[model samples]
Target: MPVARSTKAQSIKQPRAGKAPSVTENVPPEKEEGCQAKRSPSSPQGGPKKRSAFGDITNAHKNQAVTGKKEGVKAPTRKATRPPPALVVAKNNEINLKKSLRKTPPTDVPVEPEKDSVSEEPVQQVPVVEDIDKEQLGDPYASAEYAKEIFDYMREREEKFLLPDYMEKQPDISRDMRAILVDWMVEVQENFELNHETLYLAVKLVDHYLVEVVSMRDKLQLIGSTAVLIASKFEERCPPCVDDFLYICDDAYKREELIAMETSILRTLNFDINIPIPYRFLRRFAKCARASMETLTLARFLCEMTLQEYDYARERPSKLAASSLLLALTMKNLGGWTPTLEYYSGYCAQDLHPLVKRLNFLLTYQPCDKLKAVRTKYSHRVFFEVAKTTPMDMMKLEEKLKS
Candidate 1:
């Protein structure tokens, strides 16, 4: 029984098959002492492959050789033995994607620099005009932010209200008759203390209405009076009532007639009585030019006189206003139109010369016999008697434009 027990103990202690052989087991005794002093060689592949001290999930370490060192010193580590990713050699001249991802610069390999896909050019910047309204940023009533936008909008609206020589088409009324009607409207505007805008809009309404409707001569006064009433309602804070308009016309138009005429004008114009008048444009351009009250009044007088002339009706309101201001500036000898005026008014001195010539000619030569309302109105001290001021001479204006 003792002999059997000794054999059983020896069997239990013996090395099992397929287990990794000890490093000293295969190494000769002579080198076993120096193995630990230098890098240890892994066991030969003919023997069982070495298992990792730190286990791997992929079991990749099972196929690799590991040194029998206690610490991984000077031997290829588990990281170095990683499959396929260890040293990914590029097959051809092409770079391995993995190697490029590492951002490793090429060693002695000559590579041509990539060409740019598009050619580059320096952009020529446009010269920016100075903003005239920037100085008025502090004044809220001046509406400095939207001032440019507002004038531009009015200029755009001017195209819609442009008229031809409707007088040629009117058999019942002549241009002189239309002038007489507008001259009377100016008087009514003064007597009623209506705004200058009201007078301009009233005249616009009359002209636009006349273009569409052919009325008898008897209805001309009715049309003019009704136009005033419509303009008054649109522009006045306390607009004169229908009875007042009838009273002003000496009751020539009945209350029903005035109301009907108003409806007819509104409908004919599609309720578009919001015509862009020269008065508004004149005021804006005068402000932009920073003209004095006397100079502005002179411009206003010149513009108002043009209202009676049938020839000027076809002109754009903005251009008319700008030309009036330029003529006033010339007459006042305040220097020709400046860059600021040109910027805001959208008119060069050259563009205004022709219109300015005609406007100047009208004031200097137009007779004031029965059509004396505008002349008489401006002759008052309240208007600085600008009507008495001499219009700029034609030859001198030509010289000014030439400059």
Candidate 2:
């Protein structure tokens, strides 16, 4: 029994052959005691001991220091280390900046050299023509502002007084009779020394009244005379008296008859007698052409001639004026339908072609017996004798116009 007990104890004391030894089992008692002392809860250091790999490393360092002290081996004191690469570079840059600030900086700005003073000679200026007295300027209608207003007013009122197809509507009054009436009215207007606007308004009133009320051929003269009277009163500063108009009419109508016709004409026209005339347009277009007095008078002659033609009653005042001026320009050997004229008159050569041809025919070919009033009136030297000046041959004019 004692031998069996000894063998069993030997077997128990021996380690298992196949299994690996544990870390705690392989460590020496002294090393384990040191590890336990470093990790103790009641350590000399202030904080509680940490159970980590870093703590193990710190405990190993402490053990090395203690072992060195016990062995009396002197450990070398650590010297101050060089700073990091970035911090070294920053210190060098700061030293460089301080050294640069201590030195004087060179100025990059440039300086200009002074110039020698020189005396200047006085300049001689010519006297301007505009310094002359304004009263010496004779053109009252030359103001651009007033001219613009006149142009705008005429354009606005032109469409209002346009003559419709009076020939188509009136059965009693023939075109010839209408022509005769206008011709006689022109004489009356000339006799009264009335304004050109007055003459045109009077003719317009006659046509406007005729369009609304059909009148006898005999009463047509009275109608025209009454229209002139109404127009003179409306447009003229010193209009002719009713007796003067009656006297001009050869006393064919009494004072009451004249007054009755005037009332009848105004009432028929709805009292709207502010008519636009070709004469104003002629003046404007003549200025655009830079035409002479003779040229303008010729254009006026042609325009006045159109008043007698019943077919021309449908033409616009601006168009008629442009055509007349173009015809006069062509006849006077001046340039025909230039760009300057087109700019102001708003009519190109192509646009003025047909109207110009018609006017040329009226002046050259139309019989002198019927349209005698305009011809005779313009034949005088007072009119620049534009009526006596012959128009260009129609064939040659057509060729030039086509080209």
Candidate 3:
């Protein structure tokens, strides 16, 4: 991919504070397998029954699925009383993870906060953010009406799949071992031409399973492979078969063992595979900011690094994404947080500082040998060679914080 030049954001209208989120969260549309109708045979002999390369392992239960369009969520007009809407959780158990952004006290620039507080914060309103979906009225891929609602539901679901420092529970395996496994999984993703989501979800599966079950060092690869197998089922159009994964392992694990492990992971996690991933959030946040492809790729490179580190295992995916984009903007000489980004992302530039500083540190320095998967991957021309971009100075980060 050609390197994307940095682009200035369009002027943001004054941001009015959002009201309590009242959206009815909708899940993303399910992907349907495209079936090609077979031509009627010349005689009474029937054509072969439809089967998949992977035996439709992704849809073993949905072989006879109907082909019907899902109902789309309807968009609402801007309300006179309400500014832009916040993504409030519809479920009682769901907790808000996106903290309202605290203004980063500026050192050089005097950027104003979105809203001024006169006891209840009554000041000026430029243009309140209309629904983000309004611009793409008829785009099915964008899901314009329910995009925010869908992401809100994802934040709520993040709570259920949160992981503690699972390395403490593994007697035979250490963080280093897990790091190596993730590095290898990155290689697998590259080899298989898998989607980025597949890699992320596979890592999530591994962490979640390790939380519930103890395993030997040798079987760790087995667990990782099975997690990838399961993630592929969810994220890929045509995922690799059992044999493909087994072959990658050099026959270290048996087909039955891989299948058995898949059963265990699903049971342990209660079959809830719709876990929120940072990659999806990064894309959304980058779009909201109107960042350049290079800037977005840089942010992606930062976010991908966290996969190798056990420290960020429990960090909220939304927060990680917001932070990564914030740092990327700053790095590219783009202005700090804008009202539109703050409103849509539910985070201020300051809210991202802790992660921004840490991610900047990782980018500034050379990663250790085992954890170089992300850096090397991004170094290639297709990724805009973002890994080669200069890192922000830690001193500069401190100066920003002190302000």
Candidate 4:
């Protein structure tokens, strides 16, 4: 058998003097030839040596074999790590579930039949009604024919309710008597819980009916009651019954008499009960002024007070309402009547000065003795007691109005 030698043995030089001899005696000729062939041509004089791939492994194994001890290369061991708490719990749950499923026996319980998914009838959807936005109605400044037509219709209708001769026609019914009647009607209106519109309409009906028909002082209550009943029916959502009105009147007029007077009044007016009243115009003007509730209440008090005066019937309802509101704003030390007021009211400060003075005089010098109902009604806290509020100094107000 031939001796085999490693490449390490083939690369060793001969031993020098006094050094142990190199172990090249058992080196194989083939390994020596292989190592010599692998040497670089530029390094034939042997400068720095290059390493072989299996040099250290072969050397370690050869050393172990010569020392008669096995140097077994240990396989690397991995550190035992614990799984996350959630994963551990999940694995336990899976095991428990498997055990439970295996332990439980399946019973022959009857299952419910599935419901039919399709229905025989179709579902109906409701139709929605969209509201018309008032802002998009039309241009306010544009003089469209329809806008003029609307204004003309409103003005013409308003004119129809005007009682040009209301004062002259009622000779027997003095202005004080008329005021007393209206004051009593205000009480009746409140007692009946009627709308303010109903009261204004009732007063209009009384004035209009007096223009054409002769109403004795004795039948005035009957006429007022009938007018209120008709106005209530027209203005209120649920009008008072005949018995309600009769009861408020303390049974002063019988049912048949009430009905007959209502019919006569309706016929005299030709069923034109849709009269424009100061209340509507007052609200519109107050909104334009952005008056507070107290200011508006004061204006409303002034307007309602005007109802007791027969002279105010001659003035246009819209103009009277505007004047009343302007007086109220001035009396409260709020802003004077500005151009915005003029534009909305169609009256300059000079034009409204007279009407404002008239309203102020009426407010300052109210005959509470005769007009107790309206004054007392407004003096309460509910109406903000604006009736009791002092009017602005007349001189200052006059100067302001003049300016």
> Which segments of candidate 4 are over 4 A away from where they belong?
1-152
- Model 4, 1-403: lDDT tens digits are 1234553343232111101111122334664454455333333222122223224323443343333211111212321132122233334434644564455443210010011122111112222222222343576664343543543365567766667766576667877778888998999888878899899999998988998987789899888888999999999999988998788778888889988998999998899788888897787678667799999999999999888888887788888888998888887778776655666566666777788998888877776565688888899999999989987778988887776
Ranking by TM-score: 3, 1, 2, 4
TM-score of each: 0.67, 0.63, 0.68, 0.62
Per-residue lDDT tens digits for candidate 2, residues 46-120, read 114222422544344345433433333232342213212223333443454345435523221011001111111
Top-scoring candidate (lDDT): 1
Question: Mind giving the per-residue lDDT tens digits that candidate 3 earns over 1-403?
Answer: 2233221111111111221112211211221112222222211222222222112322321221111101111223323232222222212112211111122232211112222132124323443564666788798887888888888888788888778877777899998888899999999999999999999999999998899899999999999999999999999999999999999999998999999999999999899888899999999888887898999999998898889888887898889999888888888878777787888777877788888898888777745765777778999999999988888789886666545
Q: Which ten residues in a row have the lowest lDDT in candidate 1?
A: 112-121
Q: List, residue by residue over 1-403, the lDDT tens digit for candidate 1.
A: 9999986555433322112333214434454444232222232221121122112211232233222122232333322222222112112102332344246343211121111111111112222346778898999899999989998998999999999778777888988888999999999999999999999999999999988888878899999999998998899999998888888889887888888888889999999888999999898888777789999999999999999998899999999999999889888878878777778888878898889999988988995577999999999999999999977678988898787
Who is ahead in lDDT, 1 or 2?
A: 1
Worst 10 residues of 3 by lDDT: 64-73
Each prediction's RMSD to truth: 19.6, 32.6, 29.1, 32.0
Query: What TM-score number comes out for model 2?
Result: 0.63
lDDT head-to-head 3 vs 4, winner: 3
C-alpha local distance difference test of each model: 0.74, 0.71, 0.72, 0.69
Clashes of 3: 2
